[model samples]
Target: MPKAYFEPEYLNALVEVFHEAKRILERRGITHPVAVDAVARRILSLAQEGVPPWQILGEVLPPMTPEAAGLPEVASTNDIVVSGPAPDTER
Candidate 1:
């Protein structure tokens, strides 16, 4: 594969996208460092391919389920919490 070259503007845009994405994940209580890094890297790659920053971030993060973005879930009468869904529960 040939080496990919990113222009200065794209590089700057990528940096901004990475920082913003990381901040968004942090604000949403995504404390896993690896998860945040993975999303940031995905956003960077998407930005390099000419995808807008907002779209790139959206691809990795789940959309707000009409309740409001990043808001804590209000436990109602039927709230269920799962301990671990699979064998490899660590992320």
Candidate 2:
């Protein structure tokens, strides 16, 4: 049997709302997919960060963006790692 076509539960939850939101925005000439998705992604990120659903919706609705909630900043590390040469073995 083929694997199911259904999206993972987590993905579906995130996409469904955004899909609806994007369509509404597009119909209103908000064709900038990047900005639309940016907003959706911000909302979803806030949800994943444990923001209360109501609070997230309220904050995202108007006069606010994800940055307004003062979410904890994520620290980033350099992608490249440094390594020293292998040590020589004594006979």
Candidate 3:
């Protein structure tokens, strides 16, 4: 398959946007490699379509909840079930 080549200025813009997006994610405690790579791919896709860096950032980083930010879910009291010991079945 033919590789897509970008002009130097466009390539620089893409790189800048990618790094900026990554920094934003990291600030939000999203340092996972997979998440970073996914953001990079998204930035590239948008950049190829002539999207501005600010727009790319806006589109890529939506307001995410703790779950979406890769943080562990905290179980609420309603979500927790307390079970008593099982009664002897042979009694």
- Candidate 1 lDDT by residue in tens digits, 39-67: 86777676657676556657867665746
Each model's total of backbone clashes:
0, 0, 0
| Candidate 2 lDDT, 1-91, residue by residue in tens | 3222233654565555566666656654677868787878777776667664445544554433435555666557658766998677977
RMSD for each model, in Å, please?
Answer: 15.9, 15.0, 12.0
Scored against the true structure, residue 83 in model 3 reaches a CA lDDT of: 94
On TM-score, the candidate that comes out on top is 3
TM-score of each candidate structure, all chains considered together: 0.54, 0.40, 0.54
Selected candidate, larger TM-score, 1 vs 2: 1
Model 2 lDDT, full chain set: 0.59
Query: What TM-score does candidate 2 get on C-alpha atoms?
Result: 0.40
Better of 2 and 3 by TM-score: 3
For residue 56, give model 3's deviation from the true position in Å: 1.3
Candidate 3 runs further than 4 Å off: 1-5, 63-91
Candidate with maximal lDDT:
3
Error of 2 at 5 (Å): 21
Better of 2 and 3 by lDDT: 3
